[model samples]
Target: MPRLNETDRCRAVGMIEAGVRHTDVAIQFGVHRNTVDALCRRYQQFGTTRDRPRSGRPRITSNRQDTYIRVVHLRERLRTATLTARNIPGLRRISPRTVRNRLRERGIRPRRPAIRPVLQQRHRVARFA
Candidate 1:
């Protein structure tokens, strides 16, 4: 079932307080009757109807580490993702793909440095003439 935001949960609680039945509130809000009951129980347990913290997969790197990655890439614009990943002390164990993903998130795209053939002054003069 889709989750309700704080505002919707608070409104349902208000409806329950105003003598509305749980089923009626559920139908009006398009949520499950059990959800309404749970929201009420949550409000009774905790005065506020805020959502509890959810535990999800932890990030491979911290915000500081991400900033450090951005700084390293910014300082050396031509550096490759694999090289950057290897050089950062904090990101030693992380994959180069993760480093590239981080750079992509920051609007930095991975690109090969431009390669230009060397031309002597005589070559340039001959081409112009």
Candidate 2:
């Protein structure tokens, strides 16, 4: 379910402060009673119902590294992902899958070069004849 916005949170808190029961506030707002209770508690404790900043794992590669990978891939369009990953500095610890993922982010994809049999001079001359 979608989370309530600031306006709705404030209104719910206002209704709770006006002596309305938590269940009644939840019914009026079409939210769960726990949601109303949590919002009221948050308002009482934090003085605001705004979301706090979230923390997560940091990226393995920097923007400069990503650009470098893109540039190298552009210069050597036929290079395999494994070879590309090996050629990149500081990426020796990363796998070919990681290299492909980084390139995928930049809208680049690896593909095999077209295959054709080698044509000798006699074959070309016979074709022209």
Candidate 3:
């Protein structure tokens, strides 16, 4: 499941700060009581709605993709990060990180090796004894 965003986290914090019980917050957000407590603590520390360090697969995309994502911060460009041409416009939405990982997995990087085939002269320089 995707992590909660800033807005939702803020809402959760507001609900908690408003004297809502921790268990109730968990039930509302489909999380554990500990999660609610953590959210509140993080908000107190950062003064913003943020989630604690979540344990899971680390992001595959490097920081390059982060910069690229911001530079190309448009729905169309973001959607086409992988340079894949698809017919179905709204089939599936992938995170910018996913696109970078896919490109890496396919070895479709920006830099490419330079190669040149040497020519062999056979007919013109045929040796006759």
Candidate 4:
């Protein structure tokens, strides 16, 4: 499940503090009753607007400013080329499924409808006048 954003946390807190029932808060937030109860309990315990820690995929591209600059560089370098899963130095062996994800992270993508050759044999051609 996705973690709640600040807006959601604030909304939940505000609604709870406004005397809304936990079940009502859960319905309003589109979360399970237990989640609403837990958020209310957390609010009562912590008395702060800060979100609790959540477990999920760890962050990549820790330096966001540098990562954005690197993405720009990658885009400039790869713009004219057909970027397959191969050819990226550190990503040459990356899986086909993950290639797009890497490209997405780097803000680069191959041109759609990648080039393909069309061949016609002379024997297959019909005689013309």
Leading candidate by lDDT:
1
* Each prediction's TM-score versus the true structure: 0.66, 0.52, 0.42, 0.52
Better model by TM-score: candidate 1 vs candidate 3: 1
lDDT of 2 at 100: 86
lDDT of every predicted structure (CA atoms): 0.86, 0.82, 0.62, 0.62
Better of 1 and 2 by lDDT: 1
lDDT of 4 by residue, 1-108 (tens): 555677997898898888988788777777888877777778789986677688989533235433433454465654433344334444125344444555566666
Return the number of clashes found in candidate 3.
0
- Per-residue lDDT of model 2, residues 72-126, tens digit only: 8899898877886677677446667877888998899965456799988866665
In what order do the candidates fall by TM-score, top score first?
1, 4, 2, 3
- The better-scoring model by TM-score among 2 and 4 is 4
TM-score of 3: 0.42
Over the full model, what C-alpha lDDT does candidate 2 score relative to the true structure?
A: 0.82
Instruction: Give the higher-TM-score candidate: 2 or 3.
Output: 2
Predicted candidate 3 versus true structure: per-residue lDDT over 8-60, tens digit per residue: 78888999889999899888878778877888888888897755477999754
Which sections of candidate 4 miss by over 4 Å?
1-4, 45-85, 90-92, 112-128
**RMSD of each predicted structure:** 6.4, 6.7, 14.3, 5.2
Poorest 10 consecutive residues by lDDT, candidate 4:
60-69
Clashes of 4: 0
lDDT of 1: 0.86
Which residue pairs of candidate 2 clash?
none
15-43 per-residue lDDT for model 1 (tens digits):
99999999999999888999999889999
